[model samples]
Target: MVILLNCAHHLSQRLQTTFVNYGEATMYSLETCPSPWLRSHSVWGRYTVSFLLIITQLGFCSVYFMFMADNLQQIVEEVHVTSNTCQPRKFLVLTPILDIRIYMLTILPFLIMLVFIRNLKVLSVFSTMANITTLGSMILIFEYIIQDIPDPSNLPLMANWKTFLLFFGTAIFTFEGVGMVLPLKNQMKNPQHFPLVLYVGMSLVIFLYSCLGILGYMKFGSDTQASITLNLPNCWLYQSVKLMYSVGIFFTYALQFHVPAEIIIPFAVSQVSQPSSSPAWTWSSP
Candidate 1:
């Protein structure tokens, strides 16, 4: 995002107006560029990009929801199975059954509350918690992963083209914080340091992700599940890592939810002729 940051900074200085988020930046950039060719369809450019970003962010939130549900469901089921007890089916209203679908239903209320949070400052606390939980889970899993040594020759160096595409897609998905750059920079206390912050944060993420992939593969060879968490030992300690990761993914959902809400809600609010009376835009006088 160094390039994006530099361009945004240049725009901010020249225009003397802060770019709120990607939509606004794209809109303003297209509208005000020197070339008439670029300025021809600024409104369409903004709307098209906004729709694409909305889909992207919402897709991320959907993934997070399923991820948390799947991990939590597995953890719960494992515990119940070890105890030789059936997973109670009637655990609704009071609680949810040990099923991924039910876990999502159970999670929806808290998820709604989390997304309703309008302040980025407050939302950053959840983001920080997510970072902590994710790192903690990774550390815990890595501890288990490094224990079993396997021969390097046991694993294949390359996969078939189809599976290689799967790996490529997953790697790209894992590295998807680029879409948040403009909004995050807008929320920063000092936006000038965003490039440095981006570099450090992304470098750390790449290092951790690479370590997990390489080390986990070296240890497990080809006998891995969709998630590395699933390949962990079926002990209480390892099971707790699943809970930690579910919590991390839950926390991450809010950040992804924020980007789409910023774009869609503003446009929705603007569509109303009398937005002043809308409860979403303001509160009743207290």
Candidate 2:
């Protein structure tokens, strides 16, 4: 929360400075900044930010793939475990398709297609839907956590330095919304209200992250998977929740991919001859 507020304050300052210096408020993406480093005018800065953004987006995509695959695997495995008549089959049957890698591949093309949608305006609707589904998933997760309260004595209050480092990294990654702040603020109909929006939105984000992190660790202890959704009970409702959350993450992948795609695609297009041959290339062409 503090980090969010700090970022918001910094962004607010930057926006104000830009308005004062330029004599008008205008949308400014990271690459449009006056600073050579931020705007990527320098070779080092351009490559560094480009690599980091692409790597980060790829990391997010891989995580989403794993998340959906794991949940789907769990759903299928649980179904078989609970059902008496279900038998393991060979020779490339429907059961074989339940494999995690299969699930990952099944959803991969859809994600690729989604990334083709370069327009933020069109993607915003899906982003809103993703937020809604994510919220619903969180509520369901909270219900599950509260229903099975763990004894506090069994949970550790502190961890070793190594574990603390892990926690720190995780927390940083969880709250890494600073990069999105400027673009989001720029897109606002009334950019002046962005500070208020940031405060309210990030407050909720912090609250949710804190509640989920603390309660999830408390509930699952050492048995927790990378995602709390994997630890959910083997029930139809919980299974549905996992599916819903996967869909949300799937939608979110486009948003994450948008950043690096926008950064790299234009540059790539400008280098290529006859970029207008491809629709995506034309759309991204400088």
TM-score of each: 0.87, 0.74
The deviation in Å at residue 218 for candidate 1 is: 0.7
- Give the C-alpha miss distance for residue 27 in model 2, angstroms: 17
Where model 2 places Cα greater than 4 Å from the true spot, the runs are: 1-43, 82-99, 160-165, 275-286
lDDT string, candidate 1, 94-192, tens digits: 233555678889889999988887777777899899989988988888887777567878689876677887787687677456677887887777988
Winning model by TM-score: 1
Candidate 1: residue 222 Cα off by (Å):
0.9
After superposition, the stretches of candidate 1 with alpha carbons farther than 4 Å from their true spots are 31-35, 82-99, 275-286
What tens digits encode model 2's per-residue C-alpha lDDT throughout 1-286? 3454344445458766421111011223444567766555444444565577667666766777788777777666666443333122121223544567887787788888998887667778898999899889888889888765778687777765777777766766674445455556556677668778877987888888888888888887877666676677655677678878888888877777776676667678778776456555454311
Clashes of each: 0, 0
Worst 10 residues of 2 by lDDT: 18-27
lDDT of 1 at 278: 60
Please state the error at residue 165 of candidate 2 in Å. 5.3
